[model samples]
Target: MRILLAAAGLVLVYAGIVSLVSPGEPAASPQPWGFGTGVAVRPPEVSLSGGLYFKTYLWARGGGGVLYLRCYVYSRYEGGTWLPTPEEYPVLGVYSVTVGRGPFTEGGALNLTLPLMGGCVPVATPSVDGLQLGSIKVLAPGANLAASRIGLYVAYAGGRLGEVTSFYGPGDLPPSPEDLSLPPGQAGVLLALARNITAGCGDVSCKVERIKEFLKGFTYDGTMDAPWPHIPPGVDPLMWFLQNKRGVCVHFATAFVMLARASGVHARLVVGYMSDGPVPTQWSLTAFSPHAWAEYYQPGVGWIGVEATPPMGVTPPAAPLPRETPTPVATTPEAPPASPGPYQWPSIGLGVFLPLAGVAAAALVGGALFKKRVVIAVGEALRVGAPRGFWVYVNRRRVGRAPVEIVFDKPGLYLVAAGPFVRVVRVVDYRSMAGRAFEKLLKKLKLPPSATPREVAERFPQYREVALLVEKLRFGLRANKEDYRRLKEMI
Candidate 1:
C-alpha cells in the first residue's frame, strides 16, 4: 500500500513538471497600421495629461525675460478640438546659415539645437524677428523631416545681463481661415462672453488684454481628473471648461483662442516650453517645462505671443549632464545575417533538454532516499518487540500491539512509541502543500482557476517572486524547509 501511494505521488509530480516546463504557443502578429483596407486613420485625441515631452539645450547671451520653444501650432477649432494644419502644407526649408560671421551684430544671437523628439517640427525663435535660420531640413514640401537634430539661430534684443533666453520662431505665415474658426455648438456662448469681457475695449490689443485679464479669474489646476471632464454627451469641452472655470494650461490657452476668434481676431494655439530667469551660460529644461499659450495675429505687427494662463509657479529642475550626444553625419552598410550551422538544431535541443532531464533525475533520487529512510525506520520499530501486554502509541493514542504498521494520511511531524522505544519523524508531501498554497494565492488575487504562473506574473508583477517559487515547488523541484517557509510568508 505504501509503495502504491508513493508511485501515485511520483506520477502526479512528473505530470506537474512536464506541464510547468513545456513551451507556450507563439503570439499572434500585431495588426497592421491603419487596420485593414480603405479605413480612414483617425487622428490621436489630444491628451492634457501633462508629462515630460523633451529636453532643450540653449546657448544665449541676452533676451526678454521669457524664452519660448515652439513645437505644434493648432488653428482649427471644431467643437472643443484643436486641429493642426494638414501634412501637405508648405514649409520653408533651409540647409545651413552661419551667424557672427557677418557685420550684423546688435542684439544677442541664440544658438539652439534640440533633437526631433516627436512628430512636430520645433522652431527655436519666433519667425517674425527675421533671425538667421540654419540646418532646417524638410522632407518633400509638407512632410516632416526625419533629422537627428534641428539647429536654429535666434536674434533677440538684449535686456538684462547674465540672462540666458531662447525664443520660438514660428514661420511668418499669414493667418489662415482656420484661425478664425469657432466651435459650432459653443459659438453663441463664446461670442457672448467675449463681448461681455471686452465691452468697452476699442482696439484689438485692448480686446486681447481684456480676454487675458478675464481668464485670470479661472482657477489654474495642472492635475486633470479626466482628459475632458464635466463635458456631457454632445457638449463641447471648451464649453464645459467655461462653465466649470477650472483646468490646466491647455484649457486657459484654448479658451483665450476661442474668445479671441469669436471677437473677430485671428488667433492660434501654440504648444511648447517656456523658459525664463537669469543664467550665466546655459540651463536645462525638462518634461515639467511643457506648456501651452496663445498667439494672436496683429496686422503689420505679425503674430504676437499672449499669456492667458495664470502662473503655475513650476520651475524645471536642472538636468544632470546632457541626455544625448549629437550623432555624426555618416552612413554605414547593413551587415548580412549569419547562416545556421549543420549542428545548430541538435545543440539547441541538447541545451534545453539537459536541464529538464537533470531536474527529473534529481527528484527521483531524492524520493528513493526518502523511501529508504522510511523503510529503515519501519524495520527498527518492528524489530524492537514490546513487553508482554505492551501496545504501540502515536502521540499518546494507542493503535495496536508491537510490530504494528503505521500510515499517515496527512503530512506533518509525528511522535511514535511502543514499550521502551520512542521515535520522532517528519512526513512531508511538498507537491500537495504547494498546490494548496498556489490555489489559495489565486483565490486571494481574484484570478481565475485556469491562470498559469506566467499569466499571474504578467498580470500582477508584485507577485512575480511568489509565482516563480510556486512554479518550482509545483513541479517537484528541490525545495528545502526554508524555501517552503518563505513561500508561505510571501503568499
Candidate 2:
C-alpha cells in the first residue's frame, strides 16, 4: 500500500510540472517593466575634457520587422556656433566602431558620408569612420523558442561622447531595472505626489514627519550632500528619500516620481525650454536650448510639470549700463550778464500810423520768430540692420520701420534706441547740430525749414524707414504718453 502511494505522488508532481512549463494562454498586452511598461534610451553624461563614446544593446521580436538606427552628433564652436549631427567636425583623433554577430547573424557593411558637422554648413571637408549592418538572422526551427530577440551593441570614437535614445519597439518584454526604481502606484498618483512634494508633505505618517523634519532645515545654496539633501545618488530616488538625503534638480525630480510611485502614484521626467526666452542680445541663431523638469500623473488634472531645481540660482536679469563720467565745460571769455530792456516791437508798423490788424499781425510775427519749425528728413531705401525680434523704440515711443520723421516738441537732446535688446543708443542734437547743418544746406539751396517726413518719403521712400530709425536714434528723446500717442498716430 505504501509503495503504491509513493508512486502516485511522483505522478502528480510530474503532471504539475508539465502544466507550469506549457501555459494554455498567451501573455498580457503591454508587459510591465520593473516598474511600468515601455522602453527609453537616456542620454549618458560626458566630461567636458572630450573624447567620449556611446553604445547600446537591444533585442526585439514580433511585428514591424524593420530596424533603423539614426545618429546625430552636435558640436559647439568657441564663438557660439553649433554644428548638427552626422556632420564631421575637425578633431584631434580618429574614432572607429565594430559590430558582433553570434546569437544573431551579421548584415553586410555599408560606408556612407555624413552631411553636416557641428551645426554649420561645411566650409571644409571631413570624413566619417563607421560601419552599418543591415541584415536579419532567422532562428532555428527545433529550438524551444517562443520568439526571437535581437541584440545590438555600439561603441563610439573621438571628441566628447554624449548620447540620447529616442525609440524602442514592439511588445512584451520585462521592464528595465531603471523602471523598477519607480515609486509605488506611480501609474495614477502623480499630481497628488507633486503637491505633497511642493508642500513638503506626504500621506505616509512617517514620510510626512520625515519631510516635515527635512523642511525644518532647507537651504538655498543647493548642496548635493547633507542631512537635508532632498535626494541621494546610488539608490533610487524613493529609496534614497527613505534612507538618505541629497541631490540636485535631477535628483529631486527622480525622487519625487519615485516617492509618488511608492505611494501608488505615476510620474515621468519632462525636458523642455524655459518659458521666458533668453535676453535678445544673448539669444543664439543656431540650435535649440535644452532643459529638464518632471511631470506627475493625476486622475482628473492629467500630467503637471514640477520644477525641482533649487530657487537660489534662478537666471540672472539683464545687466545695467555703465555709468558715464561727466566732463567739465571750458570757459573762454564768457559774455557778461545783459541788462533788461523795455519791450520794443513793431518798428515799422507801430512807429507809423498803422491799423489794429497790422499791430496784431506784427505781434504774431514776433511770436513766430521765437518758435522754429523742425523739418525731419525722410529718405527712401533706408536699411536698419539688427537681429530678429529686436523691438525698435523711437523718441521713447515704439515705431515701425523707417524712413520716418519725428518733430521735437521741445528739442534739447533726443535719444533713440533699438530693443527689447539694447545694442546701442544714438543721440540727436538737431536743434543745435543738425539744425545748423540743415540751415547751412538750406542756405546753399535758398530753401525754407518747412520740410516734412511725408514730403521726404514721397521723394525718397526707399530710405524712409532707415532715415526715421536713425533720426529717432540720434534726435528723439523718451516719449511721454501724449507724445507716444501722437507718435503712434503719425506712424
| Best candidate according to TM-score | 1
Instruction: Kindly provide the TM-score of model 2 when superposed on the true structure, using C-alpha atoms.
Output: 0.23
Q: For residue 386, what is the lDDT in candidate 2?
A: 50
Per-candidate local distance difference test: 0.48, 0.27
Q: Model 1: what TM-score?
A: 0.43
What tens digits encode model 2's per-residue C-alpha lDDT throughout 1-491? Answer: 54454445445423432332222322222211121111222112211112111111111111221122222211211111112212222121112221123233222111111111111111100010111222122111111111012212121211221111112212122223332243233333544544555464443333423423443333323321221243323333333433344333334444444554445444444322221122121211111112233444444443333444445422212222111112111110122111112332212223221222232233344442111222232111112235344433332234443323233222222222333212112223232333234334334444332232222434567636533532342233321233323333334
lDDT of 1 by residue, 1-491 (tens): 65565556455544443333221323223222221122111112233332223334334433444545555566766655555455422222222122212233222223322122122334444322233322232211112122221222211111111122223333344677888988777788889989999898778888988998888889865442332334466656676678888776778888999999989899888676555443332322222245677888877666677777876522334434222212210111121111112222112244333333343344454554122123221101223245545565444345666655554422444444444444444456554566568768868988643344555677899989987777556432233456677889998
**Each model's Cα RMSD:** 22.8, 36.4
Candidate 2: deviation at residue 95, Å? 30
Residue 154 error, candidate 2, Å = 22
What TM-score, computed on C-alpha atoms, does each candidate reach? 0.43, 0.23
Which window of 10 residues has the lowest lDDT sum in candidate 2?
120-129
